[model samples]
Target: MDTKFDLEKISQNIVYVKPVVTADLPTEVQDQVGDLDQIYAVHNASGEQLALVADRKLAFHLAREHKMEPVTLH
Candidate 1:
C-alpha cells in the first residue's frame, strides 16, 4: 500500500460534526421537526451534508459505521 497516497486521501475520509439548534431555524422547519431543540449535523470534509442525528455520540458512531474518521467542527 502507498502510505503517501493514503495520507493525502485522509481529508476525504473525514466527517465533520456540528451542533444545530432547532429554535434558531425557520418556523416551518422547527414545526416539522417537532420538539427537537438541538441536534447534530454531520458533514463530509468537502462540506456536503451527510446526516442529522439527535446527539453527538450518534454522529460519531455514524461516521465510524461508514468507515470515516469523525471530527468536531468548532
Candidate 2:
C-alpha cells in the first residue's frame, strides 16, 4: 500500500477559522497576548496555524487578502 501527500493542494485555496481564548494559553503566551479575551485562529487547509486575529471578520479578510477561502470550523 502507498500514500502520497500533495504539498501544493495542502497549502492552497483554503483556511480554517476557529476561536481561541487567551486565558487558556500558557502564562507567558497570555502575557504577550495582552488583554484580548479571545481571538480567531486562522489555519491552512492542512491545519498549520497561520495567524491569530482579533475578530472573525478580520480572520476572513486576512484569508481573502492572501487569496485563500476562509471557512468557519463548527
Best by TM-score, which number? 1
- Residues 1-74 of candidate 2 have per-residue lDDT tens digits of 58898878755888999999988877987887788999889998778989988899999999999889899986
| TM-score of candidate 1 against the unseen true structure | 0.79
lDDT at residue 13 of model 2 (Cα atoms): 86
Model 2 TM-score relative to the real fold: 0.76
Q: List the residue pairs that clash in candidate 1.
A: none
- Report lDDT (CA) for all predictions: 0.88, 0.87
Question: Which 10-residue window in model 1 sums to the lowest lDDT?
Answer: 1-10
Tens-place lDDT per residue, model 1, 1-74, is 84556766888799999999988777877777778789888999889989988899999999999999999997
Q: Estimated TM-score per prediction?
A: 0.79, 0.76
Where in model 2 is the C-alpha error above 4 Å? 1-11
